[model samples]
Structure formats: structure tokens, C-alpha cells
Target: MEMLYAKWLFNGKEILKGLGCVSHNNMVVDLLPIKLAKKTYPEAVVKDYGEGVLFSGFVNAHTHLDLSNVSIEPYLGFVKWLKTMIETKVQANETQTDEAIKKALDSLIKSGVCAVADISNTLKSCNYLKKIPKAIVFFENYSLRKKQAQEKIAYIENNIENIRQTYKMKIDVTAHSVYSTHRDLLGYTMLKNNPKFGSDLFSFHFLESEFENPFVNSRGDLFEMLQEKGLIDNQLHFSSAIEYIKSLGDIKKGLFVHCVHIKPDEIEYLKSIDASIVIAPRSNYYISKSLPNLELLKNSGINVAIGTDSLASNWDLNIINELKFLYKHYSHIDPAYFFGIATTGGYTALNLHIGFKKGFYAYPFFMETTTNNALEEILQ
Candidate 1:
């Protein structure tokens, strides 16, 4: 047993404990209003470093660990960056894949991130996450080709099962996005969602850009871009992107990424379904130069979470950076309440079994503070 003292400890529900002791499996076993536990082995113990805030390690709800090679690319317009992303990948090379992943992981840990919802495009980063303390992998699937959607879904299903069998790690499917995924692929993937894989969480790229709005709703600019880039063939028809996703069967409990361009009706529809939204503010600003309507989201009572996205688009991968940015942009939203979105809201969105379980699960970390305000003390 080991005992440590922090100014504050954050339990699952934002409960602050002045001092706490964390046991093996990296869970907070005991916490107190005022340093309550007695040390059994004083001589063998390490010194208590005093006067610092400790909260449950931060949780980054969305990130692309594989895209760690990202540097400054063109910001503002969607098509410019999308074109660059397509053309630049072959040149970036894979030697830095490990280094970038390592750097991002290290940065997450240093920032007190205990868990992450990392979206994986391939198995390259899976090995790195295998050794991390806590991580949930989101295997990304994309199939815009009509003839290839079925095959793509089949591939994703098999790959997910393979990953589960190999690492015994928690894995979930994230249909790449409304614009990149075909209707059939989305439907098939949702229909194949099984409890056997220990993955019930669903995530998908939503409206991050105004370009995607008309394109997904009526297959407008997206279709033209696809044809121009040789990425699409037929003229697809859909009433709305949200409607297309809903048609993919019931995904009432999934995570919807980047609702910046989400229409009011779509937001209402999503709320009616009990779905949560993961806002990638930095990435949103990087791509679209605008922030989502936080006031509307708040008033709608929709659960909103935070994500740093990948370094390719954002300056950093730290969730704290995300929080600080949010503080700057959406001044109306409470920092303390938003912190929960980064931690508990994100964790729950991925269906992670959080908190303390005697034999099953372990609480990762806690926020400790002399004051009752968890966010104020930690930020200070």
C-alpha cells in the first residue's frame, strides 16, 4: 500500500478529497476530507510532496494517435487541408510513427491523462497503447465507395474481433464520418454491434464543416469533390446526414464527434436519442475557423465532451490545452462543469467501466484540493 498527499483529489463525480491513497491496479482506494488514513510503514515510505493539485488524470475523448506526424498545415478551408492530407501522407513516412505516438502518449501522461479515446486508422498504434496504463482503441472504418461498403464493414468486423482476441483490449468501431462512409457500411456496422466484444460504444465523424452540411444532406459539394478527386461515382441522395445515421439502426448511446455544423433540428433529434457529443474545439477552429454553439448545446441538456483531436490539426494533444481554449472561446460555459465533460462525460461515452470495483475495475486517480471548487484549485 502507498499513501500520497495532494491538495485535491477528483473522484468520479467531482467529489474532492484533500488527501488520498492509491493502491495497485492504479485505483484510488481511500480518500479523506482531511488526511484520514494512518501510514503503516512510515520508514519505508516516500516523502509526501506538498501543495499541488491532483485530479483524476485528464481524459482526452478524441484523438488520432496514428496521425502524430502532423505539423502546421493550411488552416481555414476544409478542401485545402483535405487535399493536403491526401497528398502529404506518403511523404511523412512511418519511421516517426512510433516517435510521434510515444511523444503524444508521454504528453498525455505528463498532463495527468489516465485514459484516452484514441481513434486508430490502423494497428500501428495498437502496440504502443498495449503498454499504456489506460486506453480504449477506436478502430476507424471508412468506405465511400458504393460497391466496397459491404466488404469494408466485413473487414472492420473481422479486424475488431481480431484485435479483441489478440490484445484483450477494449475496442470499438467509429464509422469515419457522414461524408466518408456509405449508408450501407454504416448500417452494417451498427447492425453488427455485439456485446460479446465488450464494445457497445459507437462514434462517428459528424458535421465539422459547413461544406459537409449540404454535401451530406443532399450530396452536393461532397459529391463534386469526390468526383473531382476520383473518390466517388454515383450521385447519392440523402435527406440529412443525421437521418442517414439514424437509418443505420438505433445508436442512441454513441458519441458524435464535431457537431459544429449540426443544424438545430439535428441537435434536437440527437438529444431525443440520448446521444452525447464530443467537441473537438481546437480541431474545429483549425479546420473551420469557428466554434460550436456551446450555449445551445448547454441549454438543450445534451451531454457535451471534449477532445484535443490529433496534433496534425491542433497545436497540442493535452486536454488541459483544450480546456484553456474553451475558457477563452466559450466564456459563458463554466470551467468546472466543462472539466467533467473531459473526464466523466468522455469516459462514459466510450462505455468505460469507471470508478472502484473490488475485483473488476479500479479508479484511476482523484482530484485533491483544500477548497471545494475542483476546477479553480487545479487550474490555479
Candidate 2:
């Protein structure tokens, strides 16, 4: 047994002073005061991390680890970046891809991310995501034709059980987005959601740009771009991404990434479904030159989580960097609250099992403080 005490502790809900956590073999058993921790676990070794904060590590609610191998410098042009990203993914060799995955995960882990809800296109990162304490790899399926979609479904139907058993990991099939995936594909994959992992625990890249909604609604620059590339036809259209998702099936109950163009009612709809929004503010600014209405998201009382997105758009996969960005952007809000988004808010958003049984925050860390607020100071 080991005892870890710091100036402050985050117990998956709120930060409190004068507390410590006791654990055995990497699993947290109890969170108590220093005296009680010593009394309860008399045989344990105590590590006094003085004048610092100790809590379970950050939970990255959304990221694309597969994109670790790809870095399309942001704001050159969203379309050009998109094309370059696709082209790079296609051209990269297997060894380089694997190495990049390892490098990216090492950086994330070093930066204190214990859990991740990752969006995967190739599912290459799934093999390595298990390295983290908690990982949910959402394998994105995209197909316009029902036949093609069925084939992908059949592949998962046949292999998912073994994959789960072999990998000892949680993975679910998800639609890429309203614009990229067919309704049949979306409906089919969504219906196959894992109830064990929360039936609505899916992530979609929704309304990250101004062009997204207009294209989903059938008239925009993106629509024109897809048309020019012969990628989409006049098959389906909806008033909004939310409507399009509703048209396909029931409202999902997990993190929705981006949401730069989300509306007031749409935010309420997310609340109605008990969903969380995973904001990658840095990545959003890169693609759309605007951040999500953080003021509105905060006041809306929705569970807001944080992510760095993939390195393809953002600079790093570090969750701390994400917190710092949010802090700088919304200095009005308490920085400690942003701290919760990276930790408690993220774990709750993903519906991760907490406490001794399983959870990432169950594994805590100690970071020496340098400012008034140890929590915010750790980020600095």
C-alpha cells in the first residue's frame, strides 16, 4: 500500500484541501486526510508531495491518435488542409504510422493523460490506446451505399468480440459526421452501439466550420467542394446536423466534438439527451478561425469536456496545453473549473466507471505548484 498526499486533491467532483489518497497496486482504495490515511493503512508507504496538487490524471474526451502521423498546419486553408491530411494518411507507410502512434501516445501520457476517448478512422491507434489507463476507441465508419456499409458492419459483427477480448479494450462503431456518412450507414452503425459502453457513447465531428451546416443543409462551400470532387450527390439534406442525426436515429448521449456552429436549442437538445460537448478550442480556431461560444456553453449548464484534437490541426496532444488555452480564452471563469473539465468532467462525460473498480482519475499524480491556485498553477 502507498499513501499520496498533496496540498489539494480532486476526488472526481471538486477540489478540496487537506486530503490524500491511498492505493494498492495502482488502484486507488481510499481518499482521506493524512492522519486517517496513515491510521487506516498503517503498513503503507507515504509520499509527501509538498505544496502541490494530487489528483487522477486528465481524461481527454476526444482526440484522433491515428492522426499523430499526420500534421496539416492549421489555417493555411481548411479544404487544402483536409486534402493534405487525406493524402498524407494514404501515402504513409506502416512502420512510420506505428512509430508515430507510439510517439504521440508517449507525449500524451507524459503530459498526464490517463484516459482518452479517441476518434479513429483507420483504427490503427486502437492497438496502442490500450497503453492508457482508460481508452475508448470510436472507429468511424463512412459509406454512402448500403451494401458497403453492410460489409463494414459485417466485419465488426464478426470481429468485434474477438477484438475486444484480444485487445482488452472498449471500441464502438460510429458515423464520421452528418455530412460524410449516409443515413443508412449512420443508422446501422448507431444501432449497433454497445450498451455496456453507453448506447449513445459516440463522437461525431459536427459543425466545426461555417461551411458544415450549410453543406449538411445542402448549399454551402463544402457542398460545392464535395460536388466538385464527385464525392457527394443530392441524396439527403437537413436543416441542421442535429436534425440530420435525429432523422437517422435517436439522439446519442456521448461527447459531440467541435460544435462551433451549434445553436441555443441545439445546445438544449444536447442537454435533453444528457450529452456532453468536447471542445478543442485551439483546433476549432485553426479550422474555423473562431472558438465555440464558451460563455454560452458554460451558462447552458451542459457538461463541457476538453480535448486537443489530433496533431493534424492542433500543435500538441497535451491536455495541459488545452487547459491553458481555455484559461486564456475564458479568464472570467474559474481556472479550477477548467481543471475539472480535463479531469472529472471528462470522465463523467464518457461515463467511465469511477473509484476502486476502474477509472483513470483513480490513478492520481502530484505536480508542484508555483501560483496561488495549485490546480491552475500546475497548468502554468
Which model scores highest in lDDT? 2
**C-alpha RMSD of candidate 2:** 2.5
TM-score of each: 0.86, 0.92
Q: What lDDT is obtained when candidate 1 is compared to the true structure?
A: 0.69
Instruction: Please report, in order, the local distance difference test score of every candidate based on alpha carbons.
Output: 0.69, 0.76
lDDT by residue (tens digit), candidate 1, 39-143: 543432332545544455567888988888866563747766776776676445677777888988888776767678889877667778765556888777776
Question: For candidate 1, which ten residues in a row score worst on lDDT?
Answer: 355-364
**Predicted candidate 2 versus true structure: per-residue lDDT over 1-380, tens digit per residue:** 78888887766556678776777777777777788879888999998888877767788888888877776767865666666664574445889888988998998998788889889877789889878988888878876555677687678768767876876778876778766777766776654344533364678777787777677677877677676767674456677777777765565576788888788899998898788888899898776567888888888989988898888888888888888877888887876788777877787887875432232237666677856577666655
- Model 1 scores a TM of 0.86
Clashing pairs in 2: none
